[model samples]
Target chain A: MRRRSFFQVAGATVAASTLVLAGCKDTEVVQPTTTNVLNLGSNDAGVLNYAYLLEQLEAAFYQKVLDTPPADMPKEELALFTELRDHEVIHREYLKELLGANAIPTVEFDFTSLTLTTRAGVLAAARTFEDLGVAAYNGAGKLFTSKAFLVAAGKIASVEARHAAFIHDLAQAPAFTGVVETSGRYTGMATALTPLQVIEAAVKFFPFTVITSGLPTA
Target chain B: MNLFKIIAELEKVDPEVMDRLSHRRSALSALGDFSKKMALAAAPIAVGSAFNKAMGQNTLTDANGILNYALLLERLEYSFYDQALKAATLTGTLTGAARTAIETIRAHELAHVNLLTAALGSNAAPAPANGFDFGSAFATYPGFLTVAQALEDTGVRAYKGQAGNIPRTLNPTVGGAVVNLLTVALQIHSVEARHAAHIRYMRRGATAGAQSTIFPWINNADANGAPAVVYGAGNPVATFPAESNLAQGGISNLATGLGTTYTVEDVSAAFDEGLDNTTVTAIARATATF
Candidate 1:
């Protein structure tokens, strides 16, 4: 659902409180940077805002997929993507709640380059996202200050790993299996990306000055 | 005099007041030689675990504690997987496919235990004489299922708990030892997931819903996963009386929180919270008599 539509619910009030800074008057809507960029403020909440921004982008992308699915998309693939979409939504909302009262402003994304019409394009993007998330967790694990935060990050990272594996499995075509299970097309390559690297790649994909300072400097 | 004799003579001298002349040089060199060998003897077995002390007290959870701890888990799984491989008693006659699948998983578990032990090197405590108390509770199917579920679940949590430490660079000799560790951890998690599913299936049907299931809370009655609890993403782990947690939580309601008096929700939350690999193994070891 669009942010505006999501805002219709009463839970949105509680959820909205988590997004904004304590006692802030201004709800400055930062327009999408280019067609795909988001701007995160500078703080701990900003880091979360950055993640939230990614989730928004991912959720939007998959929603688009569900709306206008691929011709070759089977029922199973369709179901999996649907599940992924719900997961992204849950992740997005979860972060929204976690960042309570300090959540950064909402941002937009640029997906103009991605060919959303085809199954191949969609799956490739999923691969990039999952890999990026894995690396992001690995790289950022050291950055989190709270021990609980690190543990939580770990839980998400494992899920990201599983997601990466799934995307990689789907990418396996023809007479090949995955390297972990068997030799396949994307066998040797990492479906993972480090946090700093993910940030850099994200910068290329989106137009946002992500200010990361308040998050744990573990 | 022979070296042994000279050493015996040297031992007779007062160590507190060594001779300060050139003649004393030989004794000092002898002591140095002995110290060097001492270092060599302990180096391979426990180098990484020891080097954790150099990490400057980030948290007391050091390499030695973690490495040996993981070794214990691998050993447990190794036993289970090995036994299951030969197990003719898998809900009656085992099909060839079932046997192969379980065996493949078994191989992976063995690899995990072996790899962990190797990492411990000489530091690894000697293997337990019999190894693992499967528990009299496991005498019945449900009892065994509960223990198996706990073990597989523990393995899942254990790997996750240590994933953070993987990239911490215990040995600078090889680049990205931590990354390798993370990879192994992920691999282990996947295999354990498969195992949990298998065990769960053997207990209830493969498609058993969360609704119809009846569970016994023999362990983790007080808490489902850990002391700290977080609902979903971006939330910090809630603190307990002792150590502050740092888990990056996502699933709000995975299992009900594992405490003495748990409801379905509590177990689900606990499952959701997940026990870190180190903590799970520690818990298992603490609970397991073996």
Candidate 2:
């Protein structure tokens, strides 16, 4: 029995090390080598990396819009987007700082899927990023083993929710009724998505694949 | 049989077993005595009952405390909006967008109250001792929006303060139920933030000078005519800092880390700070006037 248990432990350790090696290789290679996998590491690190990637996507999106805003965009609307851009940049930089050594390299996104030349289009895209961000943080909250990380994530989560509300209101003015769970046991609660669900939804904007299997499901 | 050994074995399966047992130390001691008095088969039954009792009490003492506090805030918000919507004075002055937003927010608040009450079950906090009176807030549109923003922003901070307290476990069966509490709290927390942003949007549109300062997200400790306590720090200012706080995770100057020329207000608006339970309760009670 003791020998069998030792073998089982050794087998698990080997498998874990293989996974770590694969993750490291994925990060080391810049070019898409058949599959450019972005492995969000395990446990709290995985959660932080996942958040950092989302912030990167958001910061990049807002920066693009601010760089070349639509002609029809009003001054007030432009100002709002500037704040959104600043917040996303701050979030991106802060998260990158948090991840430090565990942080994935700065991602090069493919924003071709989005329509950035028109006012309505910009609002629509902003709505998508903001809503997805809120749901991502909400879903990822329980996966954190560290309370400080959880608290820090919570701080950003609400801010993202606020951004979602503002963007949603702009996209659908006079009738924007904040993001609520329309159908569920918690009907009035906010919507939360699993990391897998979030990645699936957000994969279109990514130039490469994001492997979230390393992340904690619970 | 050794109770400690049994617990140790259970802990291997359910890591949160210690958390569940710690809350009911007296029950654990009683469990040991009861186990010795019973047959081996009966010991398992007694052990199960003791654990259930422990978990139930812990839920009441910890999780329920947070939920009940949330319930009170929800009730307060629901009542505030309910009263505003019912009042012709405020409704008369509201724009189509403002009225629609308030109605939607009021419904969401009511739904939140229902959700928390269901989560708390019989342990739900009773209705506020004193009825809510928005005072002159009901007399005008701006007044209503100001109070609404304060309430919603406070609700967001209050929920964030309690996120760490929500329990989770590795036990697949019971873990789902306990973690669901955390999930529900988070879901509600964001909704409160959404409401806060919407309220701020309406307020900014109504007032001219409020644009630069009053965006959907909070700007520094600028209370914007609501209660000052809503934006100020809690009892332990270090743990629960004011809304203008810029530092996070022991990094003193966030601007230095971000390598940006962002002002104090910009840095402050980047992150929302939490208000501890004591501060949140005092603010809520002060606003709960008839």
Strongest candidate by TM-score: 2
Please report, in order, the local distance difference test score of every candidate based on alpha carbons. 0.45, 0.72
lDDT of 1: 0.45
TM-score of 2: 0.79
Clash number for every model?
57, 0
lDDT: worst 10-residue window of model 2 chain A: A23-32
Segments in model 2 whose C-alpha atoms lie over 4 Å from true places: A1-35, A174-178, B1-61, B169-179, B207-212
**Candidate 2 collision pairs:** none
Best candidate, DockQ: 2
Q: Candidate 1, residue B189: CA error in Å?
A: 5.7
Error in Å for residue B119 of model 1? 4.1
lDDT of 2 at A124: 84
lDDT of 1 by residue, B259-280 (tens): 1222332222222234443345
The TM-scores of chain A alone, one per candidate, are: 0.68, 0.82
